[model samples]
Target: MPEAYATSAVASGATGFAPTGGVQPILSVKHIEKIYGTKDSVTHALAGVSFDVAPGEFVGIMGPSGSGKTTLLNCVATIDTVTSGHILIGGRDITNLRTRELARFRRDELGFIFQDSNLLDTLNGFENISLALSIKGAPANQIAAKVHAIAETLGVSDVLKKYPYQMSGGQKQRIAAARAMAAEPKLVLADEPTGALDSRSATVMLEAMEMMNVQFGATIMMVTHDSYAASFAKRILFIKDGTVFNEIRKGDTSRKDFFSRIMEVVSFLGGDASDAR
Candidate 1:
């Protein structure tokens, strides 16, 4: 595995974060195929899907229902096995990992944010974020510092003492974001992270995610159907019927322009225009 994919400290006081120039890809999916059911009734959820996510890049996967976006993410996350082909993360072929190694590999290399914040109601925001480090057996004395750094970066420092019930949806999601990044996993995978929030809350969550990618150099691959949420990503891959239909890069374009471009591709892929918002 390449050392570039190893977790590193966010350069303190850096304002604008850019992609890690010329680093090896943190994630590579090579000619992957996923199938379901028997010979008489087979479902091809993914077919020959391939892509590479460079170190520190924020990439989004978007597709309509049954378009195989979730299936692709599941395969990459190692939650579902690929019928064929390979998935390499940080130069390790995850598809070939043994069952026991799978659990350890996921814990040390992957971070996740789901549609729901998924915080334990019994734990306060601080403890909830700290749980990630604890599970990784980080030093007890250093856990607080790690948690505080991520919490501050995600703008949840003031609400760290509040429980999930006490905080608003946006605050809870920010706490979840803090937890995901606190572990400094090689890759962060998010599935519809803003799905449960209202427009205002979604904006706040997306902004925090952008900061995680840019300011902290977190390598993130997000699966979202909403073009608005996908706009925050530096690049997006549009999947349709289990194949890569289109891909776009933000480049030097403004986010608004990028969003418009995303919506155009979404519309081309048969997604409802209203869903783009």
Candidate 2:
């Protein structure tokens, strides 16, 4: 690990979007290594993966299946233990935290969105979102305000009262995004969030996500196999064989051009570029 990347304790009273003046990365993966199996047979799930996600940046991780992208995400999300390395979120070294502390840290610092909306069928969109804060014991009076605020930002305010089954896939995804952002987590981790949506719905969901990043200064790290979805990010890291093979920055580029660039890289990486559309 680089000396500059050493883990430090998070500052006290840090909220999810807590301002840091750009001094420290919101999420840091330093020389991470994850291997599966014993000495006799070892599977190198990750090989010296290192990266940083700065505040307010939307980072996309792209790789084909079995490329270890999901493994890396799991490691950062603390759902899987790293064989060797450090994962720092908000300056705290989560890799070393005890079980209870890990649970508490994940609940308080991390927000997650998956391919499935994961909204409770029995609950309305607002209730489904508020349930997260409620579980964290947020003040009852404040939960509604937070839910409404996030729902509005994610363009799901009108659908807040609707049940998941009653809403379209795009609406459900936007609601899920609202739930992820409402708590103001230090980082949002999304795994193929638009995988299940139709092309039109996926476009709407990506636009809403871009709004969340631009409007709320939300820091997001999403893992996707779709080129179109990845183009929405400001920067992208391409992983292959458990290591970063390449990276590209949107850097004032139009989404169409960026999509073209991403497709070129995907083709270079031997991945199917047909997914771009």
Candidate 3:
């Protein structure tokens, strides 16, 4: 890859870390817990949550409603502070980082894709991505070229100049995916990226994320209620009522087989069978 491209990837405010020898984890969370209020009236959003993601791993977090998947994502994303426990990115302890440092850590180390596109309504697709680079202080001359390159990789170059509203639901989500991967974050956190799309669109988005993981060595942690979407991940960690219920790995399993396995695990977790379809 060209230095110009690499610099842009680094600037994208998300990370797909470059090859580090079988070295260290890109992100780690341990014994994390979050309580919404004081002890008596507390709502435990996360209870002793723990996980580690290696470089280039694709992971999914699945659960029924109110399962704390989103809460877990928020804590690791550095958007919410944990009441207890620790989080580290690139082996740097982030749980204790000051506000400004945590902001920088989030910008330099993590990437996010929420259920909503979260693109600026007025900006074109390219601008939405470029804005992330801009916040990271990337030079202006390199922004357009890098955004174009990432958009091409995500198959959204045709809509580069179109505003978010001008695109279809699938198109918007693709653009959002491009933005998430644009910064080449060491880890990408996606919360229900396919939740709002039709099946065809969701498949397209999942395939794009899988390509990023396989080709760019992008590490990903996604939260979803969809078994089909979870099938794209190498492993799935199931959560229930603010605690981890179980986990399953895909290994050499085919997507169909993986989907069935995921459904079985979901059933074991007492998730509704109807939702699997």
Candidate models: Cα lDDT each? 0.86, 0.85, 0.81
* Global fold similarity of model 2 (TM-score): 0.90
Q: Each model's TM-score?
A: 0.90, 0.90, 0.88
Candidates ranked by TM-score: 1, 2, 3
lDDT, candidate 3, 1-277, per-residue tens: 3222234422232223322356577877777889898758989888777767788889998888887888888888888889999988888888889998888887877888888988899999988999888888888898888899888888899998899989988889889888888777778999989889888888889889998899889999998888888999998877777766666678897888888888877766666433443
Candidate 3: stretches off by over 4 Å: 1-23, 272-277
Clashes of 3: 7
Candidate 1 vs candidate 3, lDDT winner = 1
Give the higher-lDDT candidate: 1 or 2: 1
Clashes of each: 0, 0, 7
Q: Give candidate 3's error at residue 180 in angstroms.
A: 1.4
CA displacement after TM-score superposition, residue 48 of candidate 1 (Å) = 0.6
Which one wins on lDDT? 1
Candidate 3: residue 2 lDDT (0-100): 22
For residues 29-107, write the lDDT of model 1, one tens digit per residue.
8889899999999998997888888988999998889989999999999999999999999999999999989999888
Model 2: per-residue lDDT, tens digit, 60-126? 9988788899998899899999989888999899999999999999889999999999999999999
lDDT of residue 117 for candidate 3: 85
Q: Please rank every candidate by lDDT, starting with the best.
A: 1, 2, 3
TM-score of 1: 0.90
Name every residue pair that clashes in candidate 3. 12-183, 14-185, 15-184, 15-185, 15-186, 16-184, 16-185
